[model samples]
Target: MTTPAAADPTPTTGRRAVGGMRALTLATAFAAASGYLVMLVAGRTLGPSDYPLFATYWGAFFALGGVANGLMQETTRAVRSARVGPAAVLPAPGTGGRVRLLPAGLMLGLVLACVVAVSAPAWPRLGLPAFSGVGVAVMAVGILGFSLQAATAGALSGTERWGLYAVLLTVDAALRLGVAGVAWWAGDAGLGFAFATVAGTVTWAVMIALSPATREALTRAVDVGRRRFWRNTASAMLASAGTAALVVGFPVFVTATVRESDPAPLVGAVILAITLTRAPLLVPLTSFQSAIIVYFVQRRELGPRALAGPLGLVTAVGLVGAGAAWL
Candidate 1:
């Protein structure tokens, strides 16, 4: 009787999990398709001679945004940990000296902005020949805004607000597509497209104003103390930074090193090919990264067994994708 009672909820739990995944899949697919469209617009508008530079700039911004991704991932873990039944849970957020994420995110954003400003003098030589001080300044502002988005995304993911998270993801991709289209229409050049790249970073602001739940999520506390949170964040950032280099920053590296007879078209072709090929694999994995982490955190008692299913799915998908590409 006890075993039967315990097993009764399994079907309902599986159904909920499947529903959440379907929603996430649709959202991420839209985001991925929007990205491909944005690339097409950039390539057509910027033309061959200039598209490579835009691609490189796009890559560089996302590479730096990897730092913000670290914040999001760490915040997700911390928030989830706090909510779970822990032996030493802190006080409810916004009381008893709990440390909220927004204030910390704002401070970090300011620090990142300062770093970008200080590094402005080297912009021209550092694969940013087309960028003036003003461009760098805009990038700094974008980075500051991105920190807010990261914090909000982490908060929503941690709190199991999957509907809102899917909305956030969809809105972000839509903004990018809309802004890039406007930029092309205005003939704003690579600089305008650069702005388009970071346009979605401020989506969190709108989300906060419109959604009371988002505002409330931001107040949630981390599982750890302030010092420990930052320490863990540092480690996460280092690992994410390495990933950013290999994944997003590869175009920039190829731009620098490849010595083709007609390098402009060659580099552009390589960048486009890489982007199109990698998107199918990387986008879904990245979009679901926070959810996967949360799932594992919830099932930590299951040990390594928790990983087998997701790992097998990824492997099977990779094999199918590889075979498709080969044919």
Candidate 2:
């Protein structure tokens, strides 16, 4: 017979954990919704011509950013979790926190250059070069910025401060949308709109750099031994760059192949359909990836449940969006 006092903590703890999960889910959903609404408004207002270039440039940016950021941050989280048990790790950085920023930046630049070189031939054919060069440069900057943000977010996730991460993401998305909206309203449709995105990324990066956790992380990296730090950072960069190519390369191929025959407007419409389809799934995919990292870190096993949920959501979203496009 368990004592009431003993039994009370189990349910209470369970309730708290459940509540936290719910909050994370809601926050992610809200952020995704806000992003989608902004896209919708931008799409409607800008139409196919304007939106496609923006979308194409953005897609390329994110694909690259995701890979670079994902690899570094994911590796960092895993290493941190292993060194300090997940339960004991603090959400904020402390002395001896591990990250190699400069090497990672260089590797990211190299990868970006390679990606650009591989895709350069098709840019002119697709009319993408008109907007792509500056877009790529901006995206390159964004990749570095996002890598730092992801590192900070990864630390927060390790400590189960996902709610805080979600808040930061929501704020980031809102700021991005607001800036783009203002730019578009001011009659800066194509490249000007793209510049707004660059501004947003810069703003977010500055905010993250100013954050206490991020500042601490940088301080810790200083003592984490330059040699070992660069080694790990390089490995993570390669893995992330590969992952980015896998994700974004397909679209570049598609645009290149399609643009040879299709007009720019038609190409843009197709891209929009793909973008909208993927939009809803981004939230769940992010949640799933974060959950997997945490689960793998703690249990030393993959979370099939998390992986399955996102796959199902993505499949459903793809089907619905495709159908809408066809109609």
Candidate 3:
């Protein structure tokens, strides 16, 4: 008969899995809290009266932001999957890949411009004069800048640089939080909020540039041909857009349909409620996607029956969350 030690092959895998989860839990918590804090500060600063405009732009950002997010998730999965083999070091995603990002980013920028152009004529007629001509301009700039930085984020994800990824996310939140705080204090709440939105994104992108991992990734060559890269990126972006729309589309729609006397108050209330309610559920889900992907990759490394406990815990958490949401 085989002894217990000899029979088991995944010796230390169990510990790694558990330890990974513990560390990820902390990162996810910081990410989640910091994210929601931005919303809280924005809500307090903008107030319900003017918040609907911000909500509209916020929703639009998500809709447009989907491309970057999709790219990041797929890259992460692809990179991590590739590294599961015997190779000790995976090829760092090359620098040339970023040249490809420029066109994609430009395309997104054009889309934003077209959106603003189309909406400009209708905005003032819809009692959104302030937002139509100039407010929309700020939104476009902010979203464009945010989307431009997505490629770097995708590179970070694929390389399994979890610590750097977490730091990037945390800093993004912190920057947004700081911007919101400053806008609120300055009492230029209306325009300042939009400026803060843009500033935070620019700051996040700048911070990521300063990262050693980012610089390293930038030095590498494109892993695949242009045709194949865009093809894959397109599908990933479609899915990402769909997911982001599910979260923000309703707010955008509501704000769009609100009547002229600046029905921002009612629309703002809805946006805030949805934002607050969705945070606990969605933030953790988004934050954990990479970790969950890694978990699957490491499945065979885990001990016998190791997954059972974690799976059970996840199921229990789901049930509790669902019940609470229902209540």
TM-score, one value per model: 0.89, 0.69, 0.75
In angstroms, the error of model 1 at 194 is 1.1
Best of the candidates, TM-score: 1
| Tens-digit per-residue lDDT, 160-267, candidate 1 | 676677888899899989999999899877888888888888899989999998898898766777777787878988999899888987877866665657668767
lDDT per residue as tens, model 2, 1-327: 111111211121256445656777777777677667666666776787667666666666667666656544554454345333213222234434444543444555566556655665666665466665666566656656665555555555544444455556666677777777776577666766566554444533554556665444332222234345555556765776676555544455556466345676776677767666676655566554655565545544545654675578669988998898799
Please give the CA lDDT of all the candidate structures. Answer: 0.79, 0.57, 0.61
lDDT for 53 in candidate 2 is 64
Clashing pairs in 1: none
Candidate 1 matches the true fold with a TM-score of 0.89
Give the residue spans of candidate 3 off by over 4 A. 1-24, 87-128, 218-224, 259-264, 294-314, 323-327
What's the lDDT for residue 123 in model 1?
62
lDDT of 1 at 240: 91
- For candidate 1, give the lDDT of residue 140: 88
